[model samples]
Target chain A: MSPTPRRISTSTAVLPADGRRQNLSLVLQTLRRLGPTSRAQLAREVGVTKVTMSDLVAELIGEGRVRDVGTAEQAGPGKPATLVDLDRSGLLTLAVDLSVPARLQAAVVDVTGTVLHREERAAAVDAGQGRGLDPAVVVELVRSVLATAQHPVLGIGIGTPGLVAPDGTVRTAPNLGWTDVALRELVAEATGVPVLVTNDSDAATQAELSTSPASQDMVLVQVGRGVGCGVVSGGRLVRGAHHAAGEIGHVTVGTDGGETCSCGRAGCLETWLSVPRLRAALDAGDDPAAADSVAEVGGHRLAVALAPLVAALDLSEVVLAGPAALLEPVVPVVARSLADRLLPSLDTPLTVRLATSPEDIVLRGAAALVLWDRLGVV
Target chain B: MSPTPRRISTSTAVLPADGRRQNLSLVLQTLRRLGPTSRAQLAREVGVTKVTMSDLVAELIGEGRVRDVGTAEQAGPGKPATLVDLDRSGLLTLAVDLSVPARLQAAVVDVTGTVLHREERAAAVDAGQGRGLDPAVVVELVRSVLATAQHPVLGIGIGTPGLVAPDGTVRTAPNLGWTDVALRELVAEATGVPVLVTNDSDAATQAELSTSPASQDMVLVQVGRGVGCGVVSGGRLVRGAHHAAGEIGHVTVGTDGGETCSCGRAGCLETWLSVPRLRAALDAGDDPAAADSVAEVGGHRLAVALAPLVAALDLSEVVLAGPAALLEPVVPVVARSLADRLLPSLDTPLTVRLATSPEDIVLRGAAALVLWDRLGVV
Candidate 1:
C-alpha cells in the first residue's frame, strides 16, 4: 500500500475560477500558517491589500476555513490586535506518490502542509523499469492504499515519471514502459475522487521548492539512476512546449568516443552520472583508473555539462534529488566545476543544494500541487 | 536623426487597478488584428463572448482606434462577413535598443512597427561584454528620434541585456558593468515620454515566439560573444526569482581545469563560445584538422545544455540566435549531440532552429514587448 502525505498551502498554483474565492482562500491559508497574521501583513505577502485581506478573512472565518489564533504582540497597542490562521484540522488532503522508482507512498496532508500519515511498500510499477514490471499490479496497489486511507480525503494527487500534458495525458512513461496512457481518467474513475497527474520530477521539484527559500527562480536537478531537472521561474513550474524540458541526462560530456548511453548514443553525460551506469563503469575495472577517477576528474561530469545552463539562465542555485550515498560522492566535483565557471557579472553566488526529501515527499508534493492550485498562485 | 519606428501593436506594461479597461483594450486589439471579422472568432480567441467582442469593437470604433478593414469570406453562405483590423496608421510607439552591444541604435516606432527615421552611433557599456550598457544613452537617442517624428508616440519601450526587475530597475548587468540602475527614469527624463524596460534577450525571444508556428515550450538562445537564453514555458517567459533567467554563458563545460573565464573563473562555456574567446581559440593555429571544431562541438555543447531543459520541461524546440556566419557553424554538432542524448521514449523529434529574426531584432523585440502589454496579459 502507499504511504501517507503532507499538508499543502496553495499560492503559486492556479486559483479557482472565481477571483473572490481565490482571494478568500489565500487569506485563510496565510492566516493559518502565520498563526494569526494582521490584515496588512497578509495583504503585503499575498500582493493584495489590508482592506481586501480584512474582508476575505471575515468571509473565511464565516466559512470556518480560518479562525482567530490569538492576539498579536502589539507595540503600545491602542487595541489588542486580532491574530488569525487556518483551523489546522479543519481540512486535510491525501497525497499519493506513485512516482517512486519502486515503492508506493501515501500521506495525510493538512492545509498547513503537515503530514499526518505515512506508509512505504514495494511499488508495482517499478518492477517494469527493465525487470518484468506490470502496470496492472501497480493499479491494484494504489487501490488497496486508498481503501485503507484515513481522514476525509479532499483529493488524490499522483506524481509519476513521464510526459504529462497540460490536459492530463501521460504521453510517454519509459519507467513504466507506457505511452499515451489515459492516466487521469483511469485513476479518477477508479478512486471516485478528483485526481491530478504530474511529472514525478516536476512534483519533487515542486516539493523542494515549496518548502525552500528560493521558490521563485530555481532549478532542481534529480540525479538517480538517470538525471532530470525541473525549473521554477516567476513562482510557477516551467512546463515546456511538449513537456520535454529538464531532460539533462542526455547531455554529451565525454570528450572521447566512449560507452553507449541508454538513449542509444555514445559518450553521453548520462553514461557518467546515472547510478547504474556509474556503478557499472566503476565495476568494469576496464577504465582501471575509473574508480580513482571518480573524484579526480569525472565524478559525474555534471558540473561541466550543467555550467552552460547556469550561465545562460543566470540562476543562483541548483537543488538535487537523489540518494545520499550516490549524490554525496559527486557533489564536490560538480560544485568545484560550477565555482570555476560562474559569470563575473552575477553579484550573488550560485549555490548547489541537496533536496532533504523524506520518503513521503513525493506524495506530499503531489498533494501540495493540488493544494497550491486551490489557493491560487502567489 | 532617426527613422520612423513601426508599431508592434497596442499594449500597456502597467497592470491597472481596475481590470475592466484591461479587458476592453484586449477586445479592441483583437478586433484590430483579426479584421472586421465575426463575433465568434474574437470570442474564442479572446476568451470573451460574441456580444462582448461586438461591444468592444463598437467602443473602439467610436474612439477611432479601430475601423472596418474589409469583408470576410462567406462560410457556408451564412452572412457576407465583415472583415476588421486595427487602424494601424493611428497608433504610435517608440522602440529603443540600449542593449545593442557594439553600436548604439534607436528609432521612432509607429503602430505599424515601421521605423520612420533611424539614427545610429557607437558606445561601449560593459567593458565590451555588453552587460552594463547604459540605458540612458538609448533614452537620449529615443529623444533625438522623437524630436522630428510626425506620428503621435503613444508609449516607449526599452530593451537591454541585463536583469530587469518588474519595477523597471536593472538589478544587475554584468556585461554593462551596471547594478541597480533605474533605467525607466532616465529614459523618461530624456525622452519626456512614458517608458517600459525589459531584458534584451527576453525581448528578442518574445518577438520570436509572438509570431507564427512558435511553440509554447521553446528556448531562445541569443548567441554572441556572450551567450544568453530565454525560456518560454506554457507561453510565458520563465523569469527566475531574482528575474535573472537565460544567462547560459557561465555554465561549465570543462570536466577538468582549462582556461579562466571572463567571469573571473575557469572553464566556463562562455570562454569557449564568446566571440573574442572562440576567435582566439580558432586563431591559435592549434591544428588545421580541428578547423571544424567549433561547428562540430559548439552545437553539441548547446544541445547538451538543452537536454535537461527539454526533457524536464517537455519542450519542443530550441531557437538559436546570431548571424548565420556565427550560429551556422554549430548546427551539426548540436544535432549530433541531441540525437545521441534523446530518451528512447519520445516519438516527435525536438527541433533546433536558427532564429528567423529581423535585421534589427532587438528594436522589434522592444516594440513587441510593448505590444504584449497593450494587448493585456490576461
Candidate 2:
C-alpha cells in the first residue's frame, strides 16, 4: 500500500552511464517545470550537490542547450547567483501528423513546445484507391519543414494512424492501407535527420501528459476515423509487449450487436464510438431523441469496454479526444456507467472528460516524441 | 516503441541517498539470483567498483544478513576471492494468510523463500453467523507464531482478505468480517514486530512473481470464494488511486442475466467464476455436460472482463490461481475468447495458464511482502 516500489531487477543498479543520463534529464525537466533558477536552488531541487549541478549546467551550456540568463537579485546573500535556463527557441523539432483524413499536417516546434511554423497538404494517395499515403510525399514534406527551420533541428517525429512497431515500422494501418511501411527510415533517408514514429494515440497521450504532468495514471481515448486509446501508467506509456497496448478499437464491447466493424467484428468499440459514426448519428437531421439515443448507446459500449480497464488500473481519469459535439454527450453516459459498474470510492472518484486541445494533440505529441527521443526529456 | 522509457520526473535525479539504497538492493538481488558470489565478480555483475562491492558485502555481513561462505575456486586468478551469500536460515519472517476460508494459516519463512515451519488453525469467527474473522484471533495466532521462530524474526507479514489501505488498515474484508481494523498496528503492538499487510490476491501476485521473476506485465486472477485480480505492470504492482486497482468481482461481464451476486448485481464476473459456484455445479452428480457448460460460461465471463485489461496493458500472461480441477477447463475458453477479441500478433502471443503453486500462494506471498518491505528486495 505504500506506493508499490518498482521491482528491483538483476541490473537495477544505477551505473555511471545511467547516472549521467538520468541527471541530465532531471536538470532539463526541472528547468522546463520551474522555469529559470540559480545553480544552488537547482541543486537543492534536484537533490544533487552544488558542484555536480554546476558541472551539468556547464555541460548543457557547452552543448548550446542551455544559457545563463542573468544574475539574480541579492537577498542578503554573499554572492549574486546566476540563473540558468533552457535555450527554448534555439532548437527545433519537425513533427508530422498523418492521421488526419486525406490531409498531411506538419509543424516546426521549439523546445518550449511552441509551434513556430505549420503547413497542410492534401494527401496524394487515396484510401479509396487502396493506397496508403505515399512515403515519397511524407519525405518531401519533411524536407520542406526541415528547410524552414531557422535553428538547429533535433529530429522529425511522425504520429500516424497504425500499429507502429518499435523500429518505427507501420505494421498495419487499415485506415491508411499501409502494411509494414518503414516510415522512419524513409523520411530520415530523404531528409537526413533522425526520426521517431509512433501511433497517433500514443502521440496524443504524450501531448496530454505534457499539459498535465501530474497525471501518472490516465487513459486518453482518441476517437477519429477509428477509436483507439493511449494508456499511461506510473507516468510511462504502457506500450504492450507487441506495441499494441491501446489498440482497443477492435475489442468487442458487448453481446448486443450493433454495426459491423471493418475487422468483420460486430459491436466493436469503434463501430459505435468512432467520430464518423457519431457525427453521422448527430447529423441525422435534428432528431434530437434519436441522436441522444445513439450517443447513449455509444457511451454504454465505451463504458463496457473501459470499466474493466478503469478497475484494473485504478485509473484517475479518462480523457476523450475528438469532436466536442460528438463526445460531449458521451462523457456523462460513460461517467454514469462507470459509476454503476465500479465500486464507489470517495477517495479516488474517477473523472471522465473531453481533451482540452483535441485538435492539435497528435501534432504536438509528435513534437513531444522528438523531445523525448533526442533530449530524454518528456 | 523501444520499450517506452520511464518518464523522467523533475525529481528523478538519483541523489547520494538513493544511490546507496539502489546499489545495496541491486547487490542483494544479484546475489539472490546468482547465489554465492565473490566480491570482484559481484562488483562486475552489479556495475560497481570492487571496493564499493566489498563495502556493501561487509555491511551486510556485519548485520548478520549475509555471511562469508568460504572462497571461490581460482582459475588463473591473483587471489582466491571469498564468496559471500545470504544467511538464509539466520533470519526468519512470520507470515499469515487470513484469506483461506474457515482457516488461519501461518508460516516461518527464511530469506531463501523456504517455509521452515507451518501451522494452521480453524478460524473462530463464522461468515455464516454474519461475523468476520475476529481481530483477537489473528493477534493470538501472531503471538503463537512469534514464539515458534527458531531464529531472528525480521517482521510479520499478513495477507488478509480485504481492501487494505496504504497505512495497513483493513478497510473492509467481507470474508473476514473486518472493517476499519488496524490489523498491522494490532499485531505489531501485541508482538512488537514490524508488520506489512496487503490484500490476499496481491500477496499471491508476489508469490507468482517470485517463481517467475521475468514476468513484468502479468495479471494473477485468484478465484476462490470471490473473484479478484492482482495486476503487475512495468514490474510494479498497480495499486489504484484508492488501492482498489484489481477489484474486478463486481464488474458486470455481459448483459445476459445470471445468478445475482452478494452485491445485488446480476451477471457479475463472480457470479460465474467464484469457486463456490463452480464447485456446486461440478458436484451436481454426473452431469458432465452441465459442469462443462458452467465452466465454459465462467471462462467466457472472465474473458469478457479481462479482454479490455489485456488490451489496455498488453499483458503477456494471465495466470489463473484457484482449484486446478475447476480452472483447467476455464483456461482454454479464456484463451479462445481472448484470441477472438484481441488482435492476433505473432510477436507477443498471450499465454493463459494456471499458477503452479495455488494452494499456498497467499502464504508464500505474505513472506514475499516482508522481503520487499523490510529489505527492499523483490
Number of the predicted model whose TM-score against the real structure is largest: 2
Please write out the lDDT profile of model 1 over residues A1-378, one tens digit for every residue.
011111112111111233455456556545545566776778787676678678878887786667777778787847757777776565566676766557766666776567777665674443344543354554565576666665556666778776777656778777766677777777677778677788777888778766764456667777666777787765667766556667666666645556787667776666766666556656878774675475334454777666655655556777777766656656677777677655544456777767766445677678777766544322
lDDT tens readout by residue for model 2, B166-249: 889999888877779999888878987888999999999999988788778889999999999999887778887777778899
Candidate of highest lDDT = 2
Please report how far candidate 2 places residue A364 from its true position, in Å. Answer: 1.6
Report how far residue B101 has shifted in candidate 1, in Å. 5.7
Candidate 2 Cα deviation (angstroms), residue B22: 1.9
Model 1 C-alpha RMSD vs. true structure (Å) is 8.1
Candidate 1 DockQ category? acceptable
**Alpha-carbon error at A251 in model 2, in Å?**
0.7
